[model samples]
Target: MRVVVLGGAGFLGSHLCGTLLAAGDEVVCIDNLSTGRRTNTTPFLGRPGFEFVHADIAAGPLCVRGAVDAVANLASPASPPDYHRMPLETLAAGSRGTEHALQLAAQHGARFLLASTSEVYGDPDVHPQPEDYWGNVNSVGPRSVYDEAKRYAEAVTMAYRRQFGDDVGIVRIFNTYGPGMRPEDGRVVTSFITQALNGDPLTIYGDGSQTRSFCYVDDLVRGLVAMLTSTETGPLNLGNPVEWTVLELARIVLEVTGSTSPLEFHPLPQDDPTRRRPDIGRARRLLGWQPEISAHEGLRRTVEWFRARPAEVAAAAPSVAGPQVEPRPGARIPSPRRSAPVLS
Candidate 1:
């Protein structure tokens, strides 16, 4: 099988590509090199079955050398820092880019898997969000660019599947973290880990009571593959059921990193959610999938990855356009002016 992984060079996308290749499938990864670094995909450059294309999926279908068997559309900016920084591009990627992937999948008669997010749930009135919930989202909020874009992407995907009889699947990913995660990435785990490692004050926004469930990247990838192969075509939720408050997560990070840094509390940014966790009943019943990595184990792996990366790469990894602050862990980059609450 030849698989096209949009955003294949990104932190999660790169790992997904590696997994597919290891499973004896030919992989063609397409990335815009905006958020994804070429060095990230260097590992697969010379492989007989791997190919990389430097193009944004929103721009159009890929010009690969061969036919594709499946399309994993993981092309959008997932992190708060990335989406807030590249809002327009993020919106385009989720909406137009997703549609583009569906078209390509339809044209090639391939299975399509859309990597949706739990942000679709917004600041929910319900605890442990289930797939049946329609979600309470602020469409005009600053984070609307990414949130609404994904909602629209899911809408378009279902339209393609129902209207055109396309074979498509939607996986609503949750707060996932693991080895390939960029150290400076704005996700809480990375932020806390980096700060603790650097002996800097860990910033805790909004009194640190907001809760989120963290899923390890490997487990998330496995679930994605399972969904791809399963017969259920749905907007299925994929995340760990374990839940922890922001302050609790901070304490865990301090313990994991053995840091002496104090915790600093700050005002929560606009559209920040109060709580989020996944209900995996559907995933369990349909795909026999549940997250296997605990938050402790996953954070340990992520911290190790951050500790191993070259200083130059770590400094340059987040975004060149970001603030000029030192690239240390826990270094507080400015939040987006009109930020929406991110899934993580």
Candidate 2:
């Protein structure tokens, strides 16, 4: 199958591209690189059956030359720090970008998949949020820019599906982390891993009791592909159901990196969810998907990836001026290592 993946140069997007190519599917990857790194997609450059296009779906229409059998709209500033920094861009990507991708899919009669987020459930009243639960989001809050935009995107997708009979599916992705994640992306996993590796203190907010469910990138990508190819038209929840507190996750990071970094406490950001977990019953029943990577193993692999390229990770670390540090001239380039699957 020929597939078009927007935001294909991002952490999760790059993984999706690799997985699809490995399955012998033709892939057209498009990204604007606002938050995505070109280096993430470097492995696919000039590879057979893979094409990369530098374009922002929010800016204009995505014009591909050949037939597109599927369209996966993964284009958005996903991380809290990223969306917070680029609020307008995040909103546009969810609104305009989604509209553009939906239109393209409709034109080609292709299957459309929207990579929505668990943030839409925002500080939920319901624990282990199911797809049917209406979220308790604050529309005027600082995080609303991302949360509301995704809610809007889901609404628009449903509208298109109902009005034009488009073959569209929506997946609410939870916290996903793995090797391709930028060291300074500001997500909890990357932050903890990088800090542990650098021997810096792991920063925890709100007494470190908030909880989250993390799915390994590869497992999430498999779920994505399954949803794309399935007949279920759903706003399916996709994530590991195993839950861990912030303090527990921090401990795991330290253990994985074998670091003695002290834990530092801070005030929680506004509108931050105290607990987040997904009820992925639909995905399990319909797509037969469940994450296989345990947190310990996933963090071990992530630490190894960072340790192998310390200079690159440090250079990308966030600061007041931005990611501007220069890497050492002769730092060794580490060969890519595949993440090991968890054994039963």
Candidate 3:
């Protein structure tokens, strides 16, 4: 199949491009280096059936030649620090950027896939978040730039399907980590990894009780590919169902990297979900997909990748240790920091 991957130079998008190419599929990778790394697609530069376009879909209309079979829209600043740094761009990516992808797919009569996120379920009241759960997002909050963007993307996706009879699929991705993640991304996994490797304090913005489910990138890409091939017009949950606390994840990162970095406690960031775990019943029933890699194995591979990049990891150290938000006596742990879509 011929595929157009928007933001194909990002951590998850790059992996998606690599997977599609490995399956003998033709891939046209589009990206603006705003937050995506060119190095992610460097290996695929001369690869057969792989073409890279350096452009932002939000900035202008996309141009692709020949027959396009599918358009996988993964464009955006996905990490917390990135979206926070470029709020307007993040919002544009979700709103304008998603429309461009949908328009491209509609033009070609191809399947459109929207990569939504669990962040749409802001501080979810539901225990195990299901597709049917309408999210509790803060439209005016710091993370709204990303959360509302994705929510808007999902809304626009459904509109395209209903109004234009476009073929599309939506997948609500959870916290996925593995190789290709930028160390300075400010994600819980990346931050902990970099801080541990550099022997810096692993900052826990909260008291470390907040929970998140981490899916391995390989497993996530598999689910994405499955959704792309299937006819399911779903906001299917794509992530590991296993839950882990912030403290648990921090300990594991330290253990995995064999670092003695001390844990520093601070106020939990406002809008940071107290808990997150996707209910993938629909995904398993519809796409026959479920994560297979354990968190440990995924972390081991990720640690090795970061370990090889000593300079990047070292440089990421200072950013990981940011200004702390201290909780006063008997005060709630709510902080003023912003979350991008979903923050840990």
Per-candidate TM-score against the hidden true structure: 0.90, 0.92, 0.92
Q: lDDT-based ranking, best first?
A: 3, 2, 1
Root-mean-square deviation (CA) per prediction: 7.1, 8.8, 7.2
Q: Quote the positional error of residue 224 for candidate 3 in Å.
A: 0.4
lDDT of 3 by residue, 1-344 (tens): 99999889999999999999989998998888888899999988898899888776776556677889999999999887787667778888899889888888887899999999999998899989999999898888777888999999999999999998899999999999999999988899999999999999988877898899999999999999999999999999999999999999999999999999999987766677899999999999999999999999999999999999999998884454332233335644223222111101
**Across residues 74-94, which tens digit of lDDT does each residue of candidate 1 receive?**
998888887776777888889
Winner on lDDT between 1 and 3 is 3
Candidate 1 stretches with Cα past 4 Å from truth are: 63-65, 310-344
lDDT of 2 at 121: 95
Clashes of each: 4, 0, 0
Candidate with the greatest TM-score versus the true structure: 3
Clashes of 2: 0
**Candidate 1, run of 10 with poorest lDDT:** 335-344
The Cα RMSD of model 3 versus the native structure comes to 7.2
* Stretches of candidate 3 exceeding 4 Å from the true structure: 320-344
Q: Model 2 — which ten-residue stretch has the worst lDDT?
A: 335-344
Best by lDDT: 3
Q: In what order do the candidates fall by TM-score, top score first?
A: 3, 2, 1
